[model samples]
Target chain A: MSKALLQNEVIILDELDRQIIQATQSGLPLVPRPYHHVAEDLGVTVKEVIRRMKAMKDTGIIRRIAAVPNHYALGYKGNGMTVWDVPSELVNDLGHKVGVLDFVSHCYHRPRFLPDWPYNLFAMVHAHNRKEALLLVDTIAELLGKHDRGHDVLFSKQILKKTGMRLL
Target chain B: MDDLDRKIINLLQEGFPLTEEPYADVAKQLGIDESGLLSRLKSLLDEKILSRFGPMYDAAKLGGDFSLVAIKVPKDRFDEVAGIVNSYEEVAHNYHRDHDFNMWYVLATESPEKIHEVNADIEKRIGLKVFNMPKLDEYYIGLKLTA
Candidate 1:
């Protein structure tokens, strides 16, 4: 973990910052002066809006200011939440390896619910179809080798709700 | 998406400049005028090709608690349970997966205690156990899916 992430100190946001998030959370305006639009909406100067956003970005709250493509629309129709039942001691190492794979988007070490759920590691893989998804899973299995304890891929039946995040 | 559209998606994912004239800066790199790039982006978003086009915030870093909770809603009650679960403002993303633990959703709350509170309230309402799986460690997160 990076030092900044490990601090465990909760960075408090002032009212202005909250307003900025509320204004831009849905999306940034697609104008020539996008920040200017946000500034105008929040009743702040363009420079202040830019300054606060930059500060938030530096602190890691803003992971990145970028375009998040819909994997499905990009021809990656298949999506799988692949979970692994590797030894707890080896999970961190295995997770880092799986995470770096080009096809894997998000990977994390989460707690396991015994008996019902033995998987402790989760990685989301995307592909054009189920066949391709399985092939990518095979690559992960190959990398894991013996350390690959039993694992299962849960394909999403439907997206019940997918609002990224709402700070209401 | 055309060749230019694909190029824009690929380039923008890397990161957008936070400059005064950020769009113009990016347009220069893509060899397109600022207006053209803006129109393409608008169309992409209008078509839902790009789910979002802005800063992706980390709730934890912003002093909020989050967790991935799963529940085994009886097949008959799937939609009913989903409705009750989605009613909460804290439930950010919910999905129906092909597993015994069928319903999975993310809960984001302003305080750590709220994670449990919300889970307990949902369990009480739905009469189903909620398996709260908060991240023990984050190995990696961001990835650029090539267009």
Candidate 2:
């Protein structure tokens, strides 16, 4: 486990937590007082279900629970995974800038394997089309003055499956 | 959910009980009748919004390969390739990306040959190389939003 996890002492998840995570991930039913239904199914009280979910967030097991919306279903078509060869010294700064961009939904700084894959900073841009998506990436690169850096633009060819995590 | 929908998703997620009167069992707990709950569930699934309300076979348990693939479709022919690529039932969620290898998509297939065949076909049809990136390791936040 990462030192961060050890230091935080995240309680190792138990059966109840695992089942509860599975129940929520599958999709909450659309009805009045959903928690009541969830609680009954798990052989627990509605209040208990709420309490456990709350504890998950409190203890950092869960970040947040909200609708996992599908961007494609909403008709915003252009989505791209982009990589940038940010210098090791500037990776942290560039990663922050990339993360703050509205179109860049996800960003990370991965190790830059030299000679083969030199690009370390990765950013994802979602937009309406190639022109708009590329425009966002280009602008970010320009602002960072790393436009000359080696990068790859990976546009999605197809989506084989879209699923949430299974707690089992 | 206000009340009932929550019960249904919870039941499905927990792995639907095998007994014939599973609905009744669930209803007894929720203080409702089985028939009404079943009917409501049928509607939610029909909406296509609930992609699935069923158990997913464990991929690792079955020894399956799960990977995300990306390719660059020429700007002029994005629509054409998308149509051909999406035709395969294997392609689930696809989008046009902005990078040089413009097209990206996820592929989940059991055997390596099946995956390789997909690339071969896409290349033969579109005349572009697919950057097949197998997941060396996964660092996930579990990325599921629990509401």
Candidate 3:
């Protein structure tokens, strides 16, 4: 009956850290020495910039410095938010199982609003088309087996906005 | 995308090196020159193949709060409600989906209290109940999509 949310140790960001975030939140400068460019812009040394970034990364403030591909552009057009109304007792375990699937991008145990919404387990499935996405959902359903009370897939009709989290 | 582009995407997704000459270091590993690697990355981003190329920050870890919220908008009033919801700076990644709870978006704020405040404000403005479904448990995240 543990409904504890996964909490990471929050890190207090300093002024320079905030500045770094602002500078790089949109993107890192596409240059040979991108960190050095940021340092120059912020009136700090390259070493200082790298040190602060490393610290932030180590503390989990920055998940990772990497490239995020556009799924649609990559031909993953069938994006389905598959939600399941699984037994509360088995949600966490089932979520882990679904999450490890190659096609499942995100899996989480969320609060269920009964009467209207019964889904507590949410998994995002990506595929090349609707048929493929549904097939992937079947894979999750098979994996869940008897625990899969019921589920529904919500395909995105339109992307109104997708700016991600911008620290303002 | 060619072999080199695929290679860059796969390798970069793993992580970009944090160093004085990070791109150079990566280039050496890819057996390409520093300038060549940079150009390929630039082209990938410009061509919209790569949505983003930077540090993905964990807002919660950085002392911020975020939640997934949905509002069942009337079909006729969808655009109006969407405009109102999207007007808020806190609202990120809004989508129209195929369901009764059609309008779903994520609210990321600098404080946990702000999450509630924003949700309440949106409900009041739109005259619809905003269903806030925050994660009680994150079983897993970060699926590396192969190029």
Q: Relative to the true interface, what fraction of contacts does candidate 2 keep?
A: 0.11
DockQ of 2: 0.10
Candidate 1 local lDDT, residue A47:
96
Model 1: docking quality category:
medium
What is the RMSD, in Å, between candidate 3 and the native fold over all Cα?
2.4
Off by over 4 Å in 1: A1-7, A10-12
Clashing pairs in 1: none
- Candidate 1: lDDT of A61? 77
lDDT of each: 0.89, 0.59, 0.89
In the range B1-147, model 2's lDDT, one tens digit per residue, is 344665555444344432334567666777888777767666656654345553333232222344456666677987888777777655645655445555666665655567778767877887776666554322222112111
What TM-score would candidate 3 get against the native? 0.93
Q: Model 3 - which docking category? A: medium
For residues A30-90, write the lDDT of model 1, one tens digit per residue.
Answer: 8999899999888889999999999999888788999999988999888999999999999
Pairs clashing within candidate 3: none
lDDT of 1 by residue, B1-147 (tens): 899999999999889988888999999999999999999999999998898899888777766778999999899999999999999989989999999999999998987789999999999999999999998888777757888
